[model samples]
Target: MPKSRKRKATVPAAPPPPRRPRPRMEYRARSDEAWYGARVVVQDGWLRVMFENSTEDADEWYNPGADFASLGDVEALRARFRRECPPLDHARCGDVRPGDKLCLACDIHGDVEELKYYDAVLETVERAAHGVEQCACRFTVRWTEGPRSGCLDKVGIEVVCCVPKSPIQDPVLSEFLDDLTKRFAEDQGTATAASQQADPTPMSEEELCGVLLSLKRAPNSSTGKP
Candidate 1:
């Protein structure tokens, strides 16, 4: 009689690996940006990121210990850029409508808490995290399941990546903010000269000296005090 052929076992395709976790801070910042103008109703364990209607239709849940920055953060960042550079306009306003791609950003930081060991080391060897666990040990041991290792103390971070605002700044938003700043000498010279020529009143020496002193005291201020 002919020998019976043995059936071969078909191997299954491996499932795709899970995605890397984002840092905690990063998660906060994104949540903040996404619900910028939304009527965020934070209650219980979840947060509701809402639309202008203040209804529950559009919302997202956020857990505790997460950071969520509103549009205010973008404005603050822009303000800093403007102050430092002075040549650009760094103010961001709600003038930007929905669907418009405006500048955005966030920040995150993480620190691992507990150590994880191999499934089989006591599969006793303590976990040596390398991106993802990718090794098998020589010996076998009873394995207590520990948290899967990587960096568990995730921090999701974000920052204003980019934005489009004032028409005057259409040319360069990524460029140094000072680039959009008004060239004082070029911009105000004509007006100053014309005003000086047509002026009906000229101040006395003491008055002029006082004005100079006030200007010197608050050089950075938009208006002189004292």
Candidate 2:
């Protein structure tokens, strides 16, 4: 009988390496001038955060310190996203209508008291008397974001300001404005050069004195009496 072929010993397949836990967004932080969603994680025995909007190939770490006071719960973070402002002509409090969007300063209570601005929608507007200034106006607005989202609060013109629509929002208008600005600058430069060329050069002290002396010695041209 042919010897049974030695059965090749089969090695068991190794188990796949354990997967890393996905980062959980637990907090929001502000860096520079903008707010970003963030997650806290520990590395090398130190706490660090990864910003969701980071512009980097690898995760960038940030130290949450005094500067992180801007950091807050997700609700507060959401509030930082301000709504677009109204048109330039409608930027004044008096120009805002019941349906217009505006900004209101809100107090954030914590270890440190802070005033934060949030987007709000005007529900009602109480304008001051004809003679009174716009600052005297009052408004009822519903918070669009933040811990007070959807809550209505009465605010004064002092605490509320119109959010002006950015020129960049309209590409055509923005381009036109840019062209106008360039032309204005060029015209100003040309005007300055022309004025400089038209202006006469200053005379030296000696030349000025000599001219004055000659004028005094010469007969007065305007009056025959001289």
Candidate 3:
């Protein structure tokens, strides 16, 4: 018999290198003035970023590290933005009317001139000229708190921010409670009707009191006393 051909040992193929995790869509970077929203993209084997508020051309690419100092994810950036820049009360501003409560910025002069916000009630709103923008409308407000309390002054809409509306105005919760109350009353009425049908004669007050007293004096299992 012919000698068996020597078998060549086979080498296992190497596993592919682990892939890098893709970057999240939401990112923020700080410029000299404020935090700007940014998104990352991979182009020609290089990671690049673009800012939402960038004044530069849209096609311009920025280095992640060299361009931005403190880079943060979406949540962190939002928190920072909230802390640094309080949002304008657009809801209240939209439907502002007389007697509406508002918080407005006040310029206070002491050792240092400081801009502060104080609670106030709107007294009147003066719309801008028909040709002009509504944002130019002036509001007359009476201060309700702080050193300027009870004072009335005309201020631009920009100085005013919306007061948080009370949660009691939520119609969903009110409707739910109303439905629940009606259902509970109906159940109680049904139970009472069933009970009355079972025994048509009503119990006298004295008999009802006697029954209650007997129940009160009945055995107490835990204490072994009536």
Number of the top TM-score candidate? 2
Alpha carbon lDDT of each predicted model: 0.29, 0.50, 0.50
Put the candidates in lDDT order, highest first.
3, 2, 1
C-alpha RMSD between model 2 and the true structure? 24.0
The window of 10 residues in a row where model 2 has the poorest summed lDDT is: 1-10
TM-score of each: 0.18, 0.35, 0.33
Q: After superposition, how far is residue 156 of candidate 2 from its true place, in Å?
A: 0.4
Write down the lDDT that model 2 would get.
0.50
Better of 2 and 3 by lDDT: 3
Model 1 alpha-carbon miss at residue 141, Å: 45
lDDT of 1 by residue, 61-135 (tens): 444334324334334323322111111122322122223332221112221221111111122222222322232
Q: Which has the higher lDDT value, candidate number 1 or candidate number 3?
A: 3
How are the candidates ranked when ordered by TM-score, highest leading? 2, 3, 1
User: How much is 51 displaced in model 1, in angstroms?
Assistant: 20
Candidate 3: global Cα-lDDT?
Answer: 0.50
